[model samples]
Target: MFFSPLDQFEIKPLLILNNSYILSLSNYTIYFILVILIIYGYTIIFKNNKLSSNRYGVAIIALYDTILNLVVSQIGRQGGYYFPLIFSIFNIIVISNLLSMIPYSFALSAQLVAVISLSLALWIGNLIIGLYIHGFKFFALFVPSGTPLALVPVLVLIESLSYSSRAISLGLRLSANILSGHLLLLILGSLILSLISTSLIGFIGGIIPVIGVVAIVILEFGISIIQGYVFSILLSGYIKDSILLH
Candidate 1:
């Protein structure tokens, strides 16, 4: 039924209460709540159990340890204070992304507004943390270290722009990757479907395209985990920067 690749991103309300858009329960809400439940279930299932207890526990715990180590290395022992935040963000992204890979599931991270809002909030939180720790000196993050007073103004101006751009770039990077990958899969699937249905030779040749689709799907799965890890690493760095101001 999709006429365009972008049509996949169109959100439809499942329940519009009181004839008000504001009160509408959209598909996005459902997927988000589902993601939350899945994450909560994961915690309950894995948090209190031994890895040998469940078949999935080994892989899940390994993943938890990987992110755990990532935080500790990037932010040091104090990373424990923020590990939960990073872990939650990383799981939310990884779960939503993996969930979207399911046939007909909504891609929550593909929504620019949702992804950008989360990143923007984190960026603002970094500013607050920096201000809390360093006061007005936090603005010195724009100045770097040891520059001539004459070049300070020009360098500060450039650095300020770059610093602020993180608010948009962090989320844009994640959302753009998710959107483009899903779009590619959908387009390829559609093309192969048409090709295979056309004639005998086309059906035979569909094997390669089908193999390519499988390969890309595997790559997308890797991207889901890699993106989550990448976001965590960058956020850990930003938090470190906020605290250290170096």
Candidate 2:
């Protein structure tokens, strides 16, 4: 297969599937498959007789690093219940984001389908879980429990708007960051390559941008993990508020 500065979009070698509707195998599909395999492998590992006593503990570690970061960062002692949904989003985004770090692998995080799906999944899942846990009282999230009735309607409308906006905010935050990082790397690589093709002076000029890109890459790498944590932590807070009527 051919390689490019932005080739992470290609289908991974492990998965084989036909696509009549789309031209290429979806990156998100492959990412989810990886997630499944990791979880499945962990399940088998923990099933060994010697390790069976720690299966519950091992299962948590197997899911997603993003989820663990979130629980540790936000929920503290209260993160247990939200692990499943949080883990799914965390694993998908982390895998998608990290894949783009490698040259020629598709950047699933840069695609709207992947990022938007993550945000929507979290938003809808939170709402459903909240309703299931708290019944109609989950709507109470819009109005703080102690507020006077005169303030209730406005509070509800404002909170509802905020709630509805979560999907876009969450998706855009991650997708935009990943997209910007990839574009910056591609532009720098192009400039350096072009400069080398031309003359020594151009080649020297390319070094400046290359250095800048390297620094930015390191910074962005840390930010990627931070952003993933932020998404999960916010979800945890939302769940806490929705369920606790806070």
Model 2 spans with C-alpha error above 4 angstroms? 6-28, 35-73, 76-78, 145-151
lDDT of 2 by residue, 141-183 (tens): 8787688899889888998998899867888888888888888
Pairs of residues clashing in candidate 1: none
Cα deviation of 63, candidate 1, in Å: 1.9
Candidate 1 per-residue C-alpha lDDT over 24-73 given as tens digits, one digit per residue, 9 for 90 to 100: 98888988999999999878866564755776887788888999999999
For model 1, the run of ten residues with the poorest summed lDDT: 1-10
163: Cα error in model 2, Å:
1.0
For each candidate in turn, the TM-score is: 0.94, 0.74
Global lDDT for candidate 1?
A: 0.90
Query: How many steric clashes between backbone atoms does each model show?
Result: 0, 5
- List the global CA lDDT of all models: 0.90, 0.70
